[model samples]
Target: MAKRKIRGTEEAWETGELGRDEKYVEVADINESTIDEALELQMISIRLQKSLIEDFKLIAKINGIGYQTLMRQILKRFADSETKRLLRECVRAEEQEAKEQRQMEEIEESRKRA
Candidate 1:
């Protein structure tokens, strides 16, 4: 029989499974005593609007994530980081389009004059 190598410690086994082609996470099995010690310090509650709840559900479906998990990922991803970049690209493309349009108009005007 072939021996299988275990990761971390004997308390856990790790394997890979496709999560609706979205992403991967590591799940671990730890001693209940350890968990109890970790949970002693905090309690937090957050509220969300109904419409935003529905939109989050839709995004979670697209990303193959549970609603809560999707929310955590979004918060951690710092969603606004790309806004300035995308806006700059959009403005540059619009300017280039306008310049090309003016050039074409000038060419038509020259043809009319000829």
Candidate 2:
């Protein structure tokens, strides 16, 4: 097989001779978990409205990305913002509880002194 530079714009690619110089190797010990870990990706499935999916596809095309990638980005952003908001609410509640406890302690101390 002759090794030639592969060009996408060439007419010869349509003749199905593009990969003639390519080499193929088989791996006997492939681990899916290792591949997923290396890529930091997890597979998940969820059902969505067909209209929602069509909207995403249009928006993704306008943004020059696949709809799935756009969905992932939106999910990530929502999760991050929601996590932060929940954490802040939790902290505020804890602070308010602590303040009320201190106020009760002050009232008890005043009663004891009287």
* Highest lDDT model number: 2
* TM-score against native, each model: 0.35, 0.68
lDDT measured at residue 6 in model 1 versus the true structure, 0 to 100: 47
User: Each model's C-alpha lDDT?
Assistant: 0.76, 0.90
CA shift of 12, model 2, Å: 34
Q: Candidate 1, overall lDDT?
A: 0.76
Candidate 1 lands at a TM-score of: 0.35
TM-score, model 2 to reference: 0.68
lDDT: worst 10-residue window of model 2: 19-28
Q: lDDT by residue for model 2 over 5-97, one digit each (tens)?
A: 767755656676564444653555969988888889899989999999999999999999999999999999999999999999999999999
Which residue pairs show collisions in model 2? Answer: none
- Separately for all candidates shown, the number of backbone clashes (residues 3 or more apart, or on different chains) is 0, 0
